[model samples]
Target: MSRIHSTHDDESIGSDSFLDVVSNIVGILIILVMVAGSRAKSYVREPGEAKSNIATAMDAEAAKADLRATRRTAQSLAGELDMLTREASTLANEVKAAEYARIQLGTFVATTEHELKKQRDELDDKTKRQHDLAARMVAARRKLDDLQREQISVVSTAAPEIVVKSYPSPISATVFTTEVHYRLLNKRLARVPFEELKDLLLDERRQLVWKLEDLPEVSGSVGPRDGFRLDYHFVRTVRGGSLTAAYYIPVESNLGEPFAEALAEGSQFRRAIERLDRQNTTITVWTYPDSFDEFRQLRKELYRLGFSVAGRPLDKDSRIGFSPGGSKSAAQ
Candidate 1:
């Protein structure tokens, strides 16, 4: 019995030992599993953190690039604005200068207009005075002519017993010889330089030939030589396809010497008469009604000098005129 009990006890001790070894192995496996799980979670968190850091750095770089571009754009705009401002200032200055120039021109024009008006006023005053003087002179001459006529009529009526001495005068005939012209008006005498005026008028007509092509009539005046001017009116007519020109010369009434000066010894009339040949030259007196007595005296003096005398009576308002178809002077 004792030997059998010893064998069973040994077997039970062996089984207990086996159970303890198995428990130890299981605990170790559980510890290993926990460690592996902790290591896996740490690895996953590290990878996610690395990805977030890389994305944040890229976003920061993009923001910096955008900021740099915005700064450059701002700088360019500032430069353009400065240039525009300077141009505006220059334009303003130019406008001011133009305005000043315009004002100066306006002032100058006003001054010129005022000066011209003043000169015109002075000229008008002078012309009015001259017209008044001319009217007075005409009135005095008419009164003198009336008085002389009255005196002649009274003498003729009162002197029936006195026998008047008369010279035998030839009948009047057309003057074909060289004629010297004289103006006997305003009780004054002046030599009419008809030849000199004719020459001057010829020159003027030559110069004005171009104007006659477009104008049917052209009027002009020659120079005032020896205080006498020749005013001429030229007419151009187209008849039967032929162009014909004719001119008329009108004498000015203001050209003559006073009676006292003309009758002087060294007068222009006496000198002109002394230079003329009595045989070839005839004295032509253009007489007005106001100066009939003066004309008679001049005619007697011309007859005494052995010169043929021609008398041309003109009306009060008549102007001495010459034309291509005018009648010749009749001399006695």
Candidate 2:
């Protein structure tokens, strides 16, 4: 029993030693497995980190490029805004200048209108004054004429006896020489520029001769020389023979000085008479009914001055005229 028990103990010690060897082998195998796993994990992590770094660097570069582009865009927008602001300011200044010019032009036009109105008013006032003076002169002349008429009527009614007077002078004869004409009307006396008007009519006849070809007669007017105008009628007749003739008439208006003023020294009538040669010029008086007394006085004065006088009695409405068939003046 002791021997069997000792054998069992020895088998058990052998089994125990085998078990310890198996445990040591298993622990070494586990340690080696853990080290290999750690090395493999480190290798995989290194590759993943490299990839992440590369992606991050690319993203940062893109971001910086976008920032630079954004800055450039902002700067461009700012420059455009500044340019627009300057243009707007320039337009505003131009508008202000145009408005000022319009205001100035309006003011100048108003001033010119005011000056024109003032000048018109002054001209109107002067015209009114001149008309008033002319009216007064006409009134005074009418009154004087009436007074003279009254005086002559009274003298004629008071003495109806005829007084005969004789003067030594040459016998009456037809006037065929140079003649000086005088007009007596409205108690006024004036020289008739008959010769000058006739000469002017002759000059106009030269120009009017061509008109006779189209018409049998032509009428024309000459000057207003010395306040008298000559209206003439020219006739062209082919009866029996071709004949051209002109009939001229003197038209008178406010053409004479008042008798009192005309008889004064250095008067227009006096100066005209002084310039005439009495020896060669026969004085012809055209007398109107209203101025018969004045004409008689003028005739006596002309006779006293050694000038032969011829009297032509004309009605109030008659115009002094000359014709080819008219009678010559008989002067004494």
The models' CA-based lDDT, in order, is 0.71, 0.72
Clashes of each: 0, 0
Give the Cα error of residue 1 in candidate 2, in Å: 99
TM-score of each: 0.46, 0.48
Kindly report which residue stretches of model 1 are placed more than 4 angstroms away from their true locations once superposed: 1-159, 162-169, 239-255
For candidate 1, the per-residue lDDT at 205 reads 73
Clashing pairs in 2: none
**Candidate 1 C-alpha error for residue 119, in Å:** 68
lDDT tens readout by residue for model 1, 1-332: 34444554565465556546555655654565455455445544544575775445554555456555555655565565556556555655655565565567667777998999999999999999999999999999999999999999998886568776553357888999999888777898877777787788777777666776787777768767666777777766553112122322334655667876776789878887899889888888888898998988878777888899999898988766687767889888
> Where does the lowest 10-residue lDDT sum fall in candidate 2?
239-248
Runs of candidate 2 with Cα error greater than 4 angstroms are: 1-162, 168-170, 239-252
Q: Model 1 scores what on Cα lDDT? A: 0.71
